[model samples]
Target: MIDKTTQPALQRLRLNLRQLEVFLATARGGSTRAAADRVARSQSAASTALAELEAALGCELFDRIGRRLQLNENGRALLPRAQAIVDQAFEAQDLFLGEHAATLRVGASFTIGEYLLPGLVSRWTQLHPRSLIQLRIGNTSEVLDAVAAMDVDIGFVEGSQTHPDLVMQSWGHDEIVVIAAPGHALAQQCATPQQLSQATWVVREHGSGTRQVTDEWLLGHLEQVRIGFELGSNEAIKRVVAASDGLGCLSRHAVEQSIADGHLIELATHLPKARRKLAIVLHREKKLGRGASDFLAHCRAAAAF
Candidate 1:
């Protein structure tokens, strides 16, 4: 592998926005025809661009298999770096060509995005009207992955991430509270660990942050507790719990409105409160825009656990 210290200067020799765009388009589209469709270029133009890109970089980025061009090992290796460069290039555009260097691209997971971010974004925009803030919302794991890949400027998530390329910041705290329909039998009763273990639970689908924490809580106990159902989205889970006898785990914040509306109730008693950390994460190496910095500061100051 080339030394990391020298790759930036070496990169300048081969990197051009158009070539990178072509390469990225090919990677995303998975074929020349598809890339052409996306970029509105002819198939031959896409092919030539890929060739020129490979030649300029002194490496073949893709291997042709049948009519398809599949990413080769080298291309797979360069994808992240190439993508980072592309992201930086787009971010830098706010500096000279179009808007001032004042736009923020913020990514967030569903819980925070829906329940926590509107006021924060509004406050930031009110303070800095010239700064454009774009929001991207996804599942928790996806949001962290985007930050690690530099596809987003910064991310807010409901759980911790351990990627070495990320610097995690504790924005606040939360809890994965067990919630059921407001008038359910267990709503007013005290639930011991043993009693709680006996109940069937409706759970979130895999990859959900709430499910992860719930599983962790059940690790040393309740190996026999049954998962009654699995579904995605807080709304779906809430609907099932509201109409059925099942219970599920949810971020306390995500269900506050429903809880207030008497649609859900906490599982009984003073059992251990399974606390979760709400975090803001960023690529360890990426520079932040002034807008991103301002928004992050607002979150730190105003967003409560």
Candidate 2:
């Protein structure tokens, strides 16, 4: 093993934020040329910075395969640390700037992020112009992880998961509706499980809150439903369902515009109401900062719950 403590001070001096930034860019971009472009530096400068970082650490962080670079174990290990450092540096800077400059990091699952959050964010910004909101959009699982890890100050999710590490509060309820193209066989009639199962269906991917709810409530009755497509985005699913003979179970909010425009028709189902609660999630032990508290209040008032 190498003696890290005896390393020369010159080596320590060379491992600066610039080198870390270059390392991160290279890791993410997967090419020195792309990293150089990302960092607004010449290719040579980026390469030099990466080299300095690796040499100072006395290890190879990446495997140079022809034109592409892949992160090795060391690089992967360093990535989160480097990101934490950069984020903390920004936070420290904000501390000096003032509380109003502090940012509220928000994570939202697809439906809320794409449809609902934009209006809420706009309203919040109008009320507190000085506050900054950093938004991340992903599936329900990703939003929960962000909240658990404290990467986001708050999260909005539609999934039915309750985590011990999170404090979950009901934000509102949303209805899931069955929809199809106007010409679909079941478009004008109430859909029976047997009739629905025979039709091709376009649905969201597995990790989505909408998909989870659909699986429990719809597919639970129609076990052998014909799945035509598993789409990643709600918009894509809507478009596919609107253009094809496929049926889709989606949030009413997601399909409202399509139904209004005659692209899609909401089908009546034989089952009970498909309603689910939308929730606001946060780390259990996390103290509410001013920005987070204000945003939470806004969400509660907007939801009227």
Candidate 3:
């Protein structure tokens, strides 16, 4: 039923994984030689594959300037789809070897990475002993960027931040607690709004999920508060608050161990309880590999209880 002329066109339309892989490598590395090094092919072969892809697509995907190849409109449009296809191919290949043979790349905000993911990752690795996970830790904004750029397969973060390119799913919930050293003035008292507003606070740095929540919760209740320190690390804030008279606000998970050790005390304050939703984020266009998909399932199952 097919014509001979149409059959040749259909064959030309077929795009191969090797072409896409080379395309991705070139887009990332910016040169045929770099693409060659990345995909373990010769520079000339990489160039030939790229030319074939452009010819098949009937458009130039990049803008050439001297030795640099920058993604133009067509390339930009094709990048995500190409990435998904290549990723799916690798995932499918790994599937037959065993579920544990695939590698997963995950990104997480500081609070989730340091306090929450450890136990979950520990449990997951135990079950899939041969699986490898590369976890990158950053703040909420950084996690969003990594997920958007496909630097990681998935992301877990705290608070209510959203990215246009990502799909956010509520994973769980967390509570933010106000803390003080056991010997601090507020440790044994139910602090009033006026006292809290006057107190020196040690809080998470800007761009942090905890910091965003802290600002919203505290500012909503108190007219104005003084920030004594803005730190990147939860542990650093805890230590500063414990050694000084400054108050601290952090996740209950981050502070629980210190609270239990009698080094820090959860403050009784007049402000309302602060709670936030934890979320799992993934690129809207991304197709999850089996290992990453299974890991996501594992996390969801754990969060159910």
Candidate with maximal TM-score: 3
When summed lDDT is taken over every stretch of 10 residues in candidate 2, the lowest stretch is: 83-92
Candidate 3 accuracy as TM-score: 0.86
TM-scores for all candidates: the values are 0.81, 0.70, 0.86
Each prediction's whole-model lDDT (CA): 0.78, 0.84, 0.92
| Model 3: per-residue Cα lDDT over 1-305, one tens digit each | 89987997888566999999999989888999999999999999999999999998999999999999999989978988999999888877887887768678899999899988988999999999889899999999999988987778999999888999999998999999999999998777899999999999999988899999999999999978799999999989999999999999999999999999999999999888999999999999888877888899999998841
Clashing pairs for predicted structure model 3, backbone only:
none
Going through the candidates in the order shown, the clash numbers are 0, 0, 0
Model 2: number of backbone collisions = 0
- Residue runs of model 3 more than 4 Å from their true location after superposition: 1-10, 25-56, 62-72
TM-score of 2: 0.70
Models ranked on lDDT: 3, 2, 1
Top candidate, metric lDDT? 3
- Off-target runs (Cα >4 Å) in candidate 2 are 1-99
Which clashing pairs does model 1 show?
none
User: How much does each candidate deviate from the true structure in C-alpha RMSD?
Assistant: 5.4, 6.6, 3.4
Model 1 per-residue lDDT tens digits across residues 79-140: 66676676677667756754434557788887888788988888776776666778998888
User: lDDT at 242 for candidate 1?
Assistant: 93
